[model samples]
Target: MKKLLLIVTNIDMYASGKLRTGLWLSELTHIYHSVKEKGWNITIASPKGGAVPIDPESLKPLVLDKISKEYYENPVFMDELNHSKSLEEVKNDSFDCIYLAGGHGTMYDFPDDTNLQYIISKQYESNKMVAAICHVVGGLLNAKLSNGEYLIKGKSMTGFNWFEETIARRKKEVPFNLEAAIKERGADYSKSFIPMTSYVVADKNFITGQNPFSSKEMAKIVIRELEKV
Candidate 1:
């Protein structure tokens, strides 16, 4: 069976030290269910590893969906989240794909993670599919290919848009402008004109989703791309 490395954030609090944020439950679980149902084995990991935190707000009735709620109640899934591997524990070249799950917390740890960037670049250069959604795409900002070119340069991609950030009223809380940073890296960044809608882009082996709403679609696309490999 093909394997997938699912990376989520370890940061639980906003840089402002005022709000709590961690992995967005639906963003991970939606893709998890989608990919797992297709028989893909998944390995969950975090920058710090173990006890992955779910954004509390994501569990609220208004935000939590049937799939995410079921995942929250499923012991097997919960256990996987609780005991995710650390970046250091992940073996290079073991996975056929690498997926970065998104949340507000990713804005803190995803960017500037040299090890994570190396892992991503290695996976991409190795011809493995690499994917990310929402704020998790922040991790790709600094990733460089073996040729020292930005991995995302000239690649068409999409992630959590600035409009959505502003609509969420987190523009000030986020460490940096995710969209701006991606564009700065020369990625042909694009998003849905309507904020918070599902939007996905596939450029070569790199698949990206615009937001949590795009998670499942993103996984489906990833699976399709993997099949073509």
Candidate 2:
């Protein structure tokens, strides 16, 4: 069976005026379920190495529905989420792909995480695909290819755009701004025709989704790339 590393964050903070951690639930579910359906052996890991704190708002009935909620109740899934491997514990060479999940909290740690950067570099050097969504793409700024160039150089990608941030901000929620930082990286970026629409960018092996709405599509693109390989 193919192995896929699903990297999520265990950050739970209303820190410095910020409201939450981990990308919205709609971000992780489609990818999780899609990859599992293909018989892929998936390992869910987080920064803190235990009990990843999910955004409570995401678990609402209108969001996750019955089957997803039931799946969450399983001890196995709960265990995986609760005891996800640390970046130090992971064997980068053992996995076919690494997917970084996003949320505002990713901004807190994903970009500067040395361990995650090392893992991404190893995976990229081993000729494996590496993908990230939304703010998690910030992590790529720290990862370098074997040649020492940025992993994002010359790639067409997308992330949570500035316009969407405005809407989320206008709601008097979503503590930090995600888009401005992503655009700061200076890579070629694009978005869906509609702001905050589910948008996934597939530039060869690098896949990126714009925001929570785009997570499932991003997963599909990454899984498809793996299938081809």
* Top-TM-score candidate index: 1
TM-score (C-alpha, index-matched) for candidate 1: 0.97
- Model 2 stretches astray by more than 4 angstroms: 65-67, 170-177
Q: Write the per-residue lDDT of candidate 1 for residues 1-229, one digit (tens) a residue.
A: 8888999988899988999999999889877887788887989999888988888988999889999999999999899898999998894647989999999999888888887998999999888889999999999998899999999999999998888988888988999889999999999999998899899999888899999889778878988888877
Which residues of candidate 1, in runs, are more than 4 Å off?
Answer: none
Error of 2 at 62 (Å): 4.0
* lDDT, candidate 1, at 139: 92
Summarize candidate 2's per-residue lDDT along 1-67 as a digit string, tens digits: 7888888877766565556555455566667888889988888887767777776656777667554
Model 1 scores worst on lDDT over the 10 consecutive residues at 88-97
Model 1 clash pairs? none
